[model samples]
Target chain A: MNISGKNSISGMLKTILQICFWGGIAFLILLPILLFAIGKHLNSFVYVLYPNGICFLIFVKQFIELFNLLKENNPFCNSTVKRLSIAGKAAGIISIILGAETIFNIIVIKDEITSIFILGFMCILFLGVSIALYILSELFKQAKEYKEENDLTV
Target chain B: MGIIVNLDVMLAKRKMSSQELAEKVGITPTNLSILKTNKAKAIRFSTLEKICEILECKPGDILDYIE
Candidate 1:
């Protein structure tokens, strides 16, 4: 079938939506790493520091690179993005559980707890960002469906 | 400003069910139905090439100028 002007506009819109959804997800994935790196730097002031601190930043940077490659329509990026999103979700859930544990310890243990609070807050922030990424991943999946349907008509 | 998909014609010519075509084309039957009904918004060259190859017909066999 001929792709008329209307079809072209709608196709472009779908492509734009796909980009926005994935780009938004990439930003959300970066947010937690950014927050954690900053938190780690601040922790150095209080005689408490994070172990494996830089690893989070490095992993997230790699994910961002994958996101860019996906934007370029690299075939490998399709599967890689799905895998990284699952990994990101698991990391988020772990962070959230750790945050809850820290909060519980602060309440029950009744010790000097300002540092625990900071870490707990950072974990909660990461959880929020991670949830946003999950939503964007769902959006990407939906956009893929839309593209497939559009493809059939042409 | 009008063209119509003759997907049904191609499918009938090949004696292929929409579900079977969808399986071969790697798309769902619902989408195949939409294409057959001329309700689809776009088509990709690669997908068209695959469909034409499977149906053993030219693009003209499955598409018609409507206006």
Candidate 2:
């Protein structure tokens, strides 16, 4: 199996990310209408939804960029590390947004405790993702340094 | 960064072109250019040995240290 190329695992992951990204946009676009159709006692979840969606889109975009680097077999570069750091920050923002939304749901919505529990779980999940992304960024930084040194050893 | 590559000086003294040296050293011209421009982080002993052998000079002749 080729690791880096037009036809590779990273390429597959990139395609999946693109699907998730565009699918997310479509879902965001249709969400208000869907909520309207449901006609529940929900008060202005749009604010929370949009911010979280945008953060998720940004996070996915960063991964797409990182996968582009992987496709080029140039993953061990400064830009990859920078992209990972940005993705990590985006993930952190997502976690914060989810945390706030969870609190808001508990205070204002006050209907489904199960949904709130899910939101809290999601908040913790994104926070873990954020920390994992930061660790990956650090790993990439070290790998980039080592690659530079090795490339220069001629 | 304090270490300087004196490849040009040795190449000039030997009356050899970088392309010729790169060809004889079995390395790419881009790698040779990297070393020449001092953008290289380190030199492998094997590559240094090849360069020294090709140029008929010591490693010290191609590398210099500056404060």
Candidate 2 docking category? high
Tens digit of lDDT per residue, candidate 1, span A57-124?
44355454554554556524245548557646655765756666576667775546776777777787
Using all chains and alpha carbons, the TM-scores for the candidates as numbered come to: 0.42, 0.85
Compare the candidates by TM-score and give the number of the best one: 2
Give the clash count for model 2. 0
DockQ of each: 0.31, 0.83
Candidate 1: Cα lDDT at A133: 69
TM-score of chain A of 1: 0.50
Q: Output the worst ten-in-a-row residue range by lDDT, candidate 1 chain A.
A: A44-53
Pairs in clash, predicted candidate 1: A154-B42, A154-B43
lDDT string, candidate 1, B1-67, tens digits: 4888888877887899889988998877787788788887787788788899899999998888877
Question: How would you encode candidate 2's per-residue C-alpha lDDT over B1-67 as one tens digit per residue?
Answer: 5989999999999999999999999999999999999898888899999999989999889888898
lDDT of each: 0.65, 0.88
